[model samples]
Target: MLEKPVNEAPLADVTPPRLEIRNLHRSFEGRAVVDDVSLRVMPGQVTCLLGPSGCGKSTTLRMIAGVEMQDSGQIFVDGKLICDTVFRVPPERREIGLMFQDFALFPHLSVADNVAYGLKGSKADKRARVEELLVRVDLLRFIDGYPHQLSGGEQQRVALARALAPKPRIMLMDEPFSGLDNRLRDGIRDETLAILKEEDTAVLLVTHEPDEAMRMADEIALMRDGKIVQQGAPYNVYTRPIDRASVAFFSDANMLTATVEGALAMTPFGRFLAPGVPDGTAVDIVFRPQHLRIDFDRAGQGPVPTPVDGTPARAVVERARFMGNESLVEFRLDHDGSIMKATVPAVFLPAKGKAMWLTIRRDRCFVFPSEGGA
Candidate 1:
């Protein structure tokens, strides 16, 4: 007799979300600080909240950690509701951990004691957990060292170890690397991420640095005025930004106003067909410096005056700056006084005021609705 085969669940169906925040709202002095924010963090993945100051990223993080009360919203961890209108769990009752930007290590406590402080288990179990976490953060050798005795990176690691001591379901970090020196910050970032990944801990990290967020986050949420403007993988957001502010924040791009005429965008740099653009609409065009090509000719032939095949503007080279690995050339367009920057390899450096043709890679250009503000 043949036995009936058992049905199997898909991986996604079997895996539960580690944390969820729904319609989170908070206010201060009648102004919404965290405005209807919602996000989900899967187990072991790092989600970064990235934005400039006063954008409400930190306030949202604090609400998730239960450090601040939300006027309205729901926060769940491991499929259990922790915050809602009728029920609210205090910070100590919620199984959440936080690492502040200041490191916040106890000045009088030894590293081992600081790490073991959060564990509720017996003395021996707490000591063992602390040692294990210290080893994971590569601070085992400094177990007995006080906060004052350890270097900035070491102290940061100790703080991280302490946060992990209780093995909370989720970890929230508020600009954890912002206060450290540049060199130490990079090292500690790598070390901290590795430890978190190894333990399969879900993390919600907040930062203002675009590069840092891109490098460390599995997914990124860009916030603006207490709202999430864009959220996606780093490459998607950087390469195809949905808004001008996002494009400007992600990379060095020269933004210029352009008039859409027929199927082309008219700029100082000859006319080119605006790929995927609607005709006869005013729009903002973003040209990344890296996409602008510059070539210098020393034969005194004067650089070619090639107008973009589809557009009516012409480009004139204004200045060139050699920045070690690459040369940035500034160009003036005939239609406006606005200057455009193009980044070329150092080997292609052009003389100042040299006549050079400019061409933008239409495929890489980003066009967004003119939002007036940067």
Candidate 2:
């Protein structure tokens, strides 16, 4: 046999994506609900489909679950075509597990029976699967109990066990923990995440809550108007947002408007670089409230500028309130009288009308073209 070339490219993996969507589209009465949306999830990874209501997040999930048909594009599992314009697989045979907001447990069935509902095997095999999942979810003691006998969290766990009993390769969760009590929601969500990861199931969770997506997702697909505006890891999606709306979606934003003269937009804070932007362009400088640095006005003068903080801006406290974890101070700018907010940790409740100096981190701020600007 000939010696292998030293620089030969490595062969691609024989295993394909556990779930993949390619330019999926759906419409209703000429309105495009899900337009050319595509995404992929690998084994044991969790990808969150995050967006406001009516943005097609759930519709996309429905299409993937094989309940809703797409108008175009293809769905694939392990490189095998599952759904498209003409051909499709049955939802029950898709090997995908589903967990919804409602536990959807059968009231008449026992916990063990509910879990064994989807399993295909002899009686002994089904019972073994049910017992295994019940132990994993810590509900083995409830084996003989009916769904109505369990608390909200316990019922949800039983639902989770039922979904996992078949050992699905992909799990589609649609706000599964949203209905639980606040105290139980976090714990159940964490437990479910741990179990899914342990089972090596690719999870596609749909939720509008940013906190859930940030804490639970390995990847986030931010959808809007039937299109994904950005997709990335949680850190990148939050810190390196693609546009102004993207920033506002994750947190409250304070925007300062200025026209670019020479690749810089001047504000009371300082001139921020607008690299590659035209000289005559109008831009908006946006920063989160937590990025604002507050200091007492020293003898009616703001502090000197620094490279890290850019420049100090003067403002008067319009309102201040204690928000438990932090104090929020609203200010009216001295330069333009525009309102902005600052959040300081701890119990800081400054009197209204108090004058203060504020500085902003240039690196923490984002500059985007002002909406509707030429």
Candidate that scores best on TM-score: 2
Q: Can you write out model 2's per-residue Cα lDDT over 324-349, one digit (the tens) per residue? A: 89999999999999999999898888
Can you list the residue pairs that collide in candidate 1? Answer: 270-313, 271-311, 271-312, 272-311
The residue ranges of model 1 lying beyond 4 angstroms of the native Cα positions read 1-12, 270-280, 297-317, 347-349
RMSD values for the candidates in order, in angstroms, are: 3.4, 1.4
Off by over 4 Å in 2: 1-10
| For model 2, the run of ten residues with the poorest summed lDDT | 9-18
The lDDT of each candidate is 0.82, 0.94
Clashes of each: 4, 0
lDDT of 1: 0.82
lDDT of 1 by residue, 226-321 (tens): 998899998888887877889888778888777777777766555656666666677787868998765444453324554332222345678877
Against the true structure, candidate 1 reaches a TM-score of: 0.89
